[model samples]
Target: MNIAILMMQKNENELLKKWITYHSYLVGSSNLFIFDNGSTNNQVIEQLTNFENKEVNVLWDFNKKSDYEQRGSIFCDKIKSLDKEDFYDFYMVIDCDEFLGTVDEEGNICFDPLSLEYSLLNYQSNNELLMIDSQYYNSSISPFWFNKQPYRKCFFKKNTIAKLDQGFHHGQVTTSDKEIRTNLVHIHFHNKPYEIAKTHAKEKLTGRVSNFNLDYLKNYNGKGFHLVRFFLQTEEEYIQNQVTLNHIKSMSLYHKLKQLNLDWPFSSTINETREKLGLTDDDDSFEKVLPKFRGSIDYIAFEGEYLKIRGWGLVNYSRPIRYIFLQLTNRSRFRFEIIERVIREDVNEMLNVRGGALGFSARLKRSDLEDLTDVTASTAIVTFLNSECAYFKFDMQKKHKEFNYFSPNNLAG
Candidate 1:
């Protein structure tokens, strides 16, 4: 049974090497298809060159764009094209931080190729898209942090996959009643060790992910990539607390196995390995700061079921404001939604705000409101870090527009 593993990465040298080694063992080194995401690391480039000589098909980005959905979709199309030629019997696309394996009756996680093949083939999934459940681990505080809904990865049989959306978060199968679960689990080291995480986050948020998109912080595919505020807030905590690598991994391993009711029989070996590598929580690192909140709403528009707005904000002191509250009133009825922050340097400059990139623009869907007809009025508000808030209300029915304390040419006072 032939299998092909697909992957895309940029500058995650250590994790990328581990992923390649494990997957190469699962499927032969020759069958791995790696797409280098414009990585600048000399180690990564050198390794890719070595693999290329070893019959691994190393690919470069087809689309120059950094958007994951677009790039991932293009990769899936390439996979489908390869499937047409009957080159491989199965395909799996995964991230560098993710490791694929199966659990045995003795509760041992097996990374052996034969074990993975058996798991995939023997597992019963009525749907063509086989869903591999995930075990997500946190970087700092709670090691075995359990998500209420852990995401599932895809393992496609020959001709089973249609295409992947939003970087493999969901699969659009050609013919399938619904996605079915499989026993295969990919332990996702999503929370990178602090040092690596800093680079990864910048590459993702500022580079590939495009923080300028309106849906930047909105929840997409239950993954909450859109929850930009959550990401930022958590990052702030990590920096403030100075989270460490060893602590995260150690705690996660201990608690995750505990949650699975499995025993960690390799404790001595693990410790020895760590010691040999000189790994320590004290040495792990991360560094980044979220922009403060305190600006003005310079633009607002209503289109169909969506309420579009643009503004700039920045906090002077204390804890930064991470979210803005939008309140709507209709004949004693009230509805509101929390808006996460986004990059907006142009407006921030126009408003003469000291905080760079204080501008936020979003297209929010309001299913909560029956109609904009009777909405009567709305308020755009931002509370300061000290619990004091600045707000402005406008008549929604009469089409009143209220620019905050500042306008395009005028700075906020």
Candidate 2:
């Protein structure tokens, strides 16, 4: 079947490359449709152009709208045009931050979208949509740590007549009557405090956002949603690390009444759906399943200063070395940012330091220096000692040798 993946995004430069890579791997580069909204980065356009030349279709609309209504209207119009041209048999509306997953009857893991029986997937909603819990992680503050809570659902299937709902959280399946019951998992990426703030700010500014309340989202306590901790050490660690990561759930009845902004009583709708599905919020059936190591490293610290982190860990081979160093000299606390700076068994150059290499540096302010020292002492340092590197001989007493920090730009030769 011909399947088209639709994505609407604004200022999505950070996720653009990785999302495009995953989409290209899933359905090939030819079946993707990207809609850009007010993106400031020209690099995104250039990348999309390259993909278009390779068969992907890229559409651009610069109209600024504070609500999803305008965005959805534009999306629907574009999809209608594509449908009239007989571009696709089935189209999936996916978010830039979500990754779709499929599971079998026997509960085997399948990551490929095309490998599953796509006909069984069904979209259900109450007056309120059921929020799925997710974990939040920050690279700078916490060492790749994650907390979990529930958030609103944002995936749906569309045919020619399908249009997004008023709040833009769910969609109406207008053309199909198929009672498909496929289970698809949504993996979200907004896990940091800064990320949460930015998202909430966007939603508040954009009046057309989802109707979901921000308060109900709770923090995950290291123990991921529906997963239990195992092993003596892990159980102890779980108990010790009682930190809450951001998660969102439907508001309680009283809170729902207090924040009664929507027309329908969401509490009642949620109850009815829960009863119909024979599912209880307290169901912890998945707790017995041991957490599988997806080979994800939560956080890496280097000298309590520079940090190299992957939200979901380093899953792709193309990811460069995740090593950075924080330089604390008399002048100031300089963060040396390096991306793939490890050259043919030697250090190349350093990107940013307090002062240029081979130069005398001034002292930092007393208060700033104290603060930097405190941060450096508390931060965790991660080093890839296993990776190839050259040994440097330094003369601290002689003060005779000059050294240069390694950076990508300096090594470009």
Candidate 3:
């Protein structure tokens, strides 16, 4: 094989056609070999087979059991194999969205059109191994931090004698220098929507296996990168700082589409996928759903049968007559049985608290403890008069990695 392109995808369809078409135009589709792992949709495989390049092989059931992260590492090891006997001159493994290219002496694209073959030829003079840059682009394509693509795709060399390390970003051999000098950058356009991006962030922050880098927060630009901030900040805070949302809400979708770059059709893809997913009515604006509920239910505990609820005053409402009410309910049926009212007189003392948090508990009767179990695990909810709430689960706090906490001084109003 001269140059073989390897790709693995799951549950992806929208961009698979474009990726195959563009790359096939660059370096003959005969060199393309896609490995589909458990794609629930048949159209994804059907489209790949529908291409004119019938010689392009589609391994549909290839390693369906393994996950993306494991498959990535596997591809690194088996970088070469043709007809079960031949070896290739070089191997190219990339995601569905990544496109490769080369640059000239002054850091300008060398060719009129993108050709992986041309890029490889042009990058020969630069270095022994091409250091493909990790450049990201947003779907919206605003001229600010979202649209500007990185300029460091160093067209790496194809070492004829030895193999190199391989992964999503950087792959090198143990004996090789493993130096990354960006000669020509590979374009990685992130087409994931805000909703999907949140899931990806949660995976990075909490999942057992992840592709996220520890220092990604400091390296990537903040405007469009919320995956990093998802762990560092609250969802409410993340939405407030998002640039693409701000841009979309300010302008019409038709207006933004007019500015879409043909080479990067992410904006158009976003619109199409957004409609297909039936997410036209989705709301990401934190300000729209942020509750005006004055304070937070800081803590909740149970002493045998007695329920102890601690809370804080959120605001300094000069009116002293209005009191705080604690509504208690059983988790089994979630029916409110006890309503204890506490005086809203802790605002003055809460000012000295760390977060202006105060302590308030509701009364409990032996009859109220009928459904509450001591052996198996029991839970109860404490609502703050439609303002705020907290749940008290027996010993569940230790199991949870993240918990919501609040300060009384931080009023929603």
Candidate 4:
């Protein structure tokens, strides 16, 4: 059966080459189709010439057509315009980073998921769609890292044609028959290093740049992540220890695909993907900012239900602070949570933040605050965040103990 893949692109040159290389191995280089969304770098379009696909659609300013609710219809119309001779048994559109195939434990990409399915191998069926499962991938090069979340990419059918639903996040496919599930996995490159992400963030998605919230942008934490103990580690040291985290539920199917030897460019694509991790060679692309720890922060106030934190290091939101460095304790009990604040906001030019404080606040319920206090004394916490680049203070001692930070010689200590 013939297979074809479709994808949209904007300022996606950061990992564009590697993405194409991986896809080339999945479907032949010839079956890959791309729609250019006014790529300023022109990298996506430039690389397209390397392979011969059925069609290449370029609409430089197709913003209105790319609306969340209108994309399905726009893409369906384009698919119909393609030459009938080049018809495909299955078609699925995805982003540059999404791999609609499987990868092994050794960090290697394998064959298509369908070829390994036992039910499909014996079936002579049509009019059914496969809702491919996807796992989010974070590149060491990406800036903001969060807890992993799983999502689906597209819908594929055996015989009858179907169009992808409008929303990219939704896996629904519109057809005469309802959607049916299939055992397929796709990998999506959810995060890229901060430097590269910033380069494309403005134009990468709908309203990502044009509609950026200036008030919120200044306080944005777009830095790489690492534990505090590793803060002093050099950039080179971290590179040697980077890892590939997988969030998929099944690996049996992935491993079996590896030995099948269904023939495509596996080694070359895997190598290309691996080599692009740190992106260190390009000085301008990946900035290795030395982690600045050992800095002092202040516990500005213990407002009703919020613990206010401020200081020089926290003021500079340009740098990435991985986790929310916070700790609250009482006697032997303690509470600590990663500081991924829902409204990670900072002060805007209009003084939007309360008292124009240039930092973040960890809102605590009154009962939670009482956990750290007593009639005669209170508990204190000294923790570091930004993946451990900066520090914050949370002290509520009645007969307070000596604070090293408050000493005469330890202003920046």
Give the TM-score of each candidate: 0.52, 0.42, 0.46, 0.45
Question: Residue 175 lDDT in model 3?
Answer: 33
Query: Judged by lDDT, which candidate is best?
Result: 1
TM-score of 4: 0.45
Minimum summed lDDT over a 10-residue window in model 2 is located at 351-360
Give lDDT tens digits, candidate 4, residues 147-231: 1233545545433444556544444334445544443445555444433444444443334323345554444443222112132
Kindly provide the TM-score of model 1 when superposed on the true structure, using C-alpha atoms. 0.52
Regions of candidate 4 where Cα sits further than 4 Å from its true position: 52-69, 80-86, 103-109, 112-126, 141-148, 158-163, 171-177, 205-211, 214-413
Model 4, residue 91: distance off in Å is 1.0
**Candidate 2, TM-score vs. the true structure?**
0.42
- Runs of candidate 2 with Cα error greater than 4 angstroms are 66-68, 106-109, 117-160, 166-168, 175-181, 192-413
Provide the clashing-pair count of each candidate structure: 13, 27, 16, 11
Instruction: Name the TM-score of candidate 3.
Output: 0.46
Model 1 error, position 239 (Å): 9.2
Candidate 2 per-residue lDDT over residues 1-413, each given as its tens digit: 55667777666655566666666666667878787765666887777778778887677654355434355656566667777776465555666755444433222224464653352233322222222222122211222222222233433333434665433455544544332223444444442223333443444344332322443222223212122112112322432333332211211212322343322212343345335545354222112212211122222322232333221211011122233223334422333243332222111122111111121111112222234433343222122312224211111221111111222121101
Give the CA lDDT, 0 to 100, for residue 286 in model 2: 18
